[model samples]
Target: EGEWKVMLFTCSYSVGGVHGHLVDYMQPEAVSTLLGMTYGEYDKRYKSYFGDVIRKTFFDDVGFVHMEQTWTPAITEIFREKYGRNPALYYPALFYDIGPETGAARIAFYDIRSELMAEGYVRQVSEWSEARRMRSMGHPPENYSPNSVVAHGDILKYYRHVDIPLLDAILCFRRGLNGFKQVCSAADLGDKPVVGAELCGAYPEEMDSAMLYRTTLEAMARGVNFVVSHGMWYDTDPQTVRIPPLIAPENPLLGPALKGYSTSTGRSCMLLQGGRRIADIAVLWPINAIQAESYMFRDAESGLPIANWHPNDVVNYALSGMLTNDLHRDFTYIHPENLTDGKVSVEGDRLRLNNAENLQEYSVLVIPGGGYISAGALARIGEFYDNGGKVIALASLPS
Candidate 1:
């Protein structure tokens, strides 16, 4: 028997998938079923529904086994039943000799926001009993979360461009800015040109490894922590699930090139991750404005509601980017709700970011746009101004 370390670095089961068999995870029926089994008021017994479903899906459809089976020595009841005694072997212990084992849960930009509000989207037929109760109570209401809406054009954009950034503004960004030493960026978000940021790309058979290294380095002066080779093909000859351009042992130059790049970038990330970020500016995330725009508009061409970020892309993307990379001054995105919740505090001419142990004191609060700002947010801003903290409002003041 042997043991090995395993870490799931890339898992996107949260949003499902775009193409390939993984897309089955995104299907409405399957998603609805999974959502209900996990979050819906089915019973305490169904508490493990979400994990069990993931296990069943990956194991039954794909040849790959679940993480628990791979990492742990625990035997399942089925295995115990099949054999008279406890099964002596466990894979990957059964497969290869692994020395020390470690497991870390990794995620892309997605937070637990979607799961937190799962009940809002219970399938109508599935909720027939609940629907009856609502009807008896006078009127049933639709889910308020924007994810429930059907938009014309690409649905993936709704998640990629909108939900991710919104969560960043409201929750994740604060934690990231305050405490995280090294920020892990994925292909989509990491693609932004930042001084010490990483970039992800795939397909080595088609692309030269040298070019990949050079281009990535050229994008950022300090280079990247690591270039995530989007994927590696497991079996070259059998090619059963080949999604080329294959880049692993199969691609001659890729492995060595990446190794070299990693070696070159090693100390850079170490140094970058050590320092406390300095910021004199705080940007008030205009989430309310974006939400209002989403509710008010439908695209003339696609008949879909405009992409959630499209309405305020200027403030969210361009301005933020200008401050982040172009200006080279560190800034934090302030969620409006955080103001009402006392997460943001004012002290004489400075606004203090309170979510972290090392409170980030900022000299100026920059409020982007003048759309549907909440009264609480306005009051907080007013208090900041009253306390002599400088405030900058773009376009117009909140009405």
Candidate 2:
């Protein structure tokens, strides 16, 4: 039996409860008896080690769960071992400018942190699920905003191992619609068959059938095929409820519409799933620029540390809104890592995004305004431009 202890931290927000942090999920000592083995050895034995739990659960799907701000001393040690340098040395650069190497250090810090999470935790669970004939699904917090860097490292890289990339869509409809394109883009780039939204959890009590249907359809139009309504409650007492908009048959207003909503959503998912997304434009995700531009500084009044808002933070959301709503043109976001890793390439007058199962060709490569870019991605863009592909640079050119 696994005897893992929860690490709790006080909630910073108004929710006012202690948040429990799980073990890094890669920690052999906490998870199983497979201690003192190298990661390679652990990987080989992971499936069989978890066989009893997998068999006992009798579940067709497994979730890796939400990984948000999951960092520890063990992670730092692994980071040092993997990168051959202590991450502590980069702290000055990570938070504030240290000199010429500051940008490079920040880039490396964020990149390695993202890589460690993806390889150490996310990929392990994903591969395990695949081996067990179960599907893996989940999302990191702040998945839809520039805050994704602080929360999940790199949103695109974070989802690389996930079988179904999910986005948490809470709050009101207007606010919830902001980051759907980003998650959908991850699914498209990965060639994953399904994209999920954990929707309508914290909406007001006034949330009606119209609001629910509108939100669902909007999410669907943005490339979501799976919807996990967040969620139904067992207890109907209003006093026991925490998150609002309780989705249950007991709810007097939205209850009667549940059955029909479920049916239509099912049909929608069946039609949208397993199809290649067709788009002529590919927006570069500019994660490199975002990482390079972001830094922490002390707040003026409270004297607390805070992250500065970079101008490029909302560029993705803005571009998505323009292309998707105004221009009526469809597009997908291609990550800078994809370009650097050779998953994306120049094919004559087109840029081809190729993965294990899906291939998408874009005629126009739209690079949004960010002053910094990875050299490898820049080289790929140059090659594409030289090969006669349309290159659109928004705001300013990346240095």
Candidate 3:
């Protein structure tokens, strides 16, 4: 029988978590890109590995991936050349904006509702109205888009610093489907085999398999075909199995469903085995529980609230472990007897991997910066660069 392939739901740096963690996804030439070396310098290092494959096939090893906020025509083209497949992109549902930067989105909406009216969309009208009001005041409400038509109702400005300008970006996408109709118009993404693909804090912690299963069933009936699930944030730290801060320990987030999916991950299909799946329906479950138990999510990362997103806060307060049920007919994720034995960790703090010596043996690492990584870590990352290691760092590297 042929092996069943699994898709890994990952955002380039979300997989890394920090600069040293960037070794989790690095290639030799990536090191040159870091130190500002010319492609020739990169090629010099590249030849050390497998000769011309560096110029020809290095990126092929990384396979299919989507940048959370950096999806562009050029990026799309790059993926096509390497994977021979279209790449999935992440578009936030918060607001829409597109044009030659004439600020068309701002003028398009008489308010948020008018755009919906223009698009003839009627689902969740009140929510749209609230977002409109917030946008007008230079403050937009929070929103999550699992699929085009289906959005969760966990709106709240957890960012503290409002995302009013995000409206422009969303407008660019939404109105494009209708000749720049209204900036606030959503993309013509009506039930396009949507996947909740990934979520941070859309579900409340009180939710369990019953709620997750029921929601999945309804969304699928509405047009969604699968559920990729948002987790299994394992790393080689071997000491910290961090989960997101929005899950509850006793909730079904730690149940059998996820474990089944994890086993699906270990299968030998080139895609699944490669660890690159854009989940169609991801339940952001248990990491929430781990956070609540430790109160890690409540603290801030360099002043920002740790559980920065409120719905995420609710999730962390609810989950207990990392076991998933079989949304598919296959394997599951089992709870780690020792948290260190697993890959996901959630002490709630961002940007701390103990010390510098911990960065060996990793091929690619991610450095997530809510704003910026610490100076000490930054220098350590420079060493990683000097050593010809690769990093998938954010905030630390220029995009």
Candidate 4:
């Protein structure tokens, strides 16, 4: 079974003066209105709401719950508690250039939002699942792109509590394939045994068995050990089917090969599961740089204020292609949060991620040209370099 938390696009709630939609660009007025309210009131209310829903679902014998599109707006109270400052003071900086402090304010704003979503919602659900001996998994929207700054703050932190770090691969085989590394890297850092991909939804109706197999192989090659084919439709009548290329037996073109394909994938997973990936390069996720550079501007076409485009947005995507296809070097993304939290450290001329299951040691660190970096991460990078580890800065250096 599946459940959506906080924001579901169509329906959502305001928690602590934070509107579920447009989280990244909330105005001062919206946040100021909640100042008179008691601290933690909205947080408690949200916890109650989540607890009630999960309790009822679990009572009905559902062993697993996939929390879909999990994200939260920046709660004013949470911002104050976590950052020790009133978020209303920095509202302008979050959306526009106010002064020299704009960049720093933007980074702090997004950072707290990321922490809130991970701790308040994701961690709560994960703990509940652990207690109940069930499992929790899901991926936020735009998990692959720079839009993740607006969608969920930071991808790695967003999956801090997920039992299986999952990524959504939709449309054609090639689209969004670059995102597999992000999810797989999260699983690797967290020492998660399984990495999942929701495969091949919204592909063309003519998509054949070969396309399915190819997509599956691509995902596997990127460290995905579990595959959840998009769906089996209750009714596959061509006239009524909502999303095409159904995986059920009703699809005459692909049904006959499903059993063999399933067996092949199973065999592949059997060999790959519980294995550690060896990558000599550690690519910094550059989330702080992305956050500092991102801001809302009015869209010329729609007249709506939207997150503006920036070159830093595609750095990871471009790097993924170059490293995987062109350079043919295996790499893993290291979140800056890990550095700040001391989960990553320098050891004997190598940067090491201290995961319980998959302890990764990197001889080189690649910073993908984002302008800003957290002080904690920069310190670690300095240590790595000073200790004789190779540090490669692409395009530009962090200020």
For candidate 2, what is the TM-score?
Answer: 0.80
Ranking by lDDT: 2, 4, 1, 3
For model 2, name the residue pairs that clash. none
Candidate 4: tens digits of C-alpha lDDT, residues 48-88: 55434542111110110111122244466776877788767
Runs of candidate 2 with Cα error greater than 4 angstroms are: 1-22, 25-89, 297-308, 312-314
lDDT score for residue 202 of model 4: 89
Candidate 3's C-alpha runs over 4 A off are 1-196, 199-206, 235-253, 258-399
Query: Residue by residue across 34-94, what tens digits does model 1's lDDT show?
Result: 5466535643454354334421110011111111111111223334554443333322222
Candidate number of the best lDDT: 2
lDDT of each: 0.38, 0.70, 0.25, 0.69
Give all candidate RMSDs, comma-separated: 21.5, 8.6, 26.9, 10.1
* C-alpha positional error of residue 326 in candidate 2 after TM-score superposition, expressed in Å: 1.5
TM-score of each: 0.48, 0.80, 0.22, 0.79
Full-model lDDT, candidate 4 = 0.69
lDDT of 2 by residue, 1-399 (tens): 799644333222213223353444444344333222433464476666554554211111112223223344555566577678866766666556778777777777667667766665566656656766566778876565544565566777778888888886777785636567888898888889898888888888878988889888888888899988875777878777788788888787889999999999999999999967788899998777777755543112223222224454337667888887788788889988787777888889898888766678899999878877888888898998999999988887866
**Candidate 4: where is the Cα deviation over 4 Å?**
1-74, 297-308, 312-314
- Model 2, residue 340: what's the lDDT? 73
Candidate 1 is scored at a TM of 0.48
